[model samples]
Target: MNLDRSIDDYLAHVRTERGYSEHTVAAYRSDLVDLAGFASGRGVEGVAGIDLALLRDWLWTATERGLARTTIARRAASARGWTAWLHRRGLIAADPGLRLKAPRAQRTLPRVVAERALADALAALADRAAGDDPVAVRDAAIAELLYASALRVSELVGLDLADVDRRRRTVRVTGKGSKERVVPYGAPAARALDRYLEVARPAILAGVAEHGKNAGGAAAPTAVFLGVRGGRLGVRSVHRQIAAMLSSIPGAGPSGPHALRHSAATHLLDGGADLRAVQEFLGHASLGTTQIYTHVSAERLKQSYRTAHPRA
Candidate 1:
């Protein structure tokens, strides 16, 4: 099969059959597209030309170009998966990528906002929401639920009104790999959500209708969060909101929605929540992925001891 056609078929298989998220599929597409261009430059356009030597050379060229180890690693992974799929389909006699490898990506701890800092930030948001500004109210709810449930921003924005069960104080979220889980939130989050749903959301929608600017059209109305233009909230908008919220607080690391997620998970661990329970709560397919919070917790403890203890 031709390289581009094989890539398209693999992307479709992952997107539909394997249930990979669009973000993941896009990453795979990017890596494979680059590979195709590189191969074409070498006068090798067929899948048969993708030998182990060629794959290694591609990674080496990426390294020489000063791409981050993580980027190169992801590219290598993308190549490996595609080549294996081609081999399985009998398009290639053997999997060239079976022996392909890249430098292991460094594992950095996720950013965890200090509990007091996060609480104060939420309180400030709540105070602004008290003015009954629809956007303020919505932002408050978004921030609260993000920390309260430790949800990925994608999962948070993808929420629909029917997904929330206010009486039960729980929300049904579809997470990575399209896995579904019902996660509970605290009363604070529940209150924020109630105010947004009962007051803010309707006002925003009504205002959009009054102005004849329902940019979201039919799709906006059912979403749990909406942009100012009445469209469903997007991932970048949420990132900007959370980034602005976290900017003033003193912290190193990304100030995005996942920082709140890392904060929530670390705090849960510090408060003695069980590891497996947190694993389930975060909808992590692997407990190993969830164990990163333990490292965060330990690091926090050491910092506290270094600051408070008088020992040499």
Candidate 2:
């Protein structure tokens, strides 16, 4: 019945039973901790003390403290989920959050690098990788596959050697909610991946052997991408690499691997790819989630027309 105990139990349920990702579970933990602290200050320390008014006031206090609308909305959702769980478990007499509401977060369009700019940037990377420096070769492959397949950084890092089909130019990726999809890569990405596998990957494996770190026994490490230490690459490393690359390019919004994803999706739409097909390609569960690219495309068209039309 303790609020803290209930929150921990709910988080464990979501993580173990519901299969929510670590990142999602962490966010829920953060929100619930903050709410628990707020509730304690108001003499409400038990699950039974949680009421709709307390929930609304907590959100109002968050807004008063100038938290972003997205943060406030997410906090509301977290609290609502927690309260609902308690009610379902018979800890609370009734769910107080059934009518809970928070301000909607403003939806902003994702940053889309111009096709020419992205092509030029990749060309520079390819040239650097031509010398077959292991890191450069691996980087080129990473960037190419990211943009080509519009893959999430996690999906890119999660790839195992057997998941890729070089002949088919496709990679099997596991996306959100543990959904698996086979996505195709362009010729450029295929070439880059081949170079990495043939030239660079061997060098890395040799380095790993030198360090006596081939702990996977007689079989090679299954990870398609590896760190300098010969272990599977991490997501933060990919984010750092892509952010550094995108930082040099002029743009607003995010400067990370996701920009490549946004660019690929927008470019596909601009090139007249079908909306639903693009949705499936991106492994989006909702058509509405995929529709954001259409907005980006329309915004680009308006900007182009404004620049070209003399009547404006």
lDDT of 2 by residue, 38-81 (tens): 99999998988999999999999999999999999999999889
lDDT of 1 by residue, 1-312 (tens): 789999999999999999999999999999999999999888898999999988888899999999999999999999999999999999999999999989999999999998899999999999999996999999999999999999999999999999999999999999999999999999999999999999999998888878877644654778999987788999999999999999999989999999999999999999999999999999999999999999999998899999999992
TM-score per candidate: 0.98, 0.94
lDDT to native, each model: 0.94, 0.91
Cα error, residue 20 of model 2, in Å, equals: 1.6
After superposition, candidate 2 runs with Cα above 4 Å error: 211-220
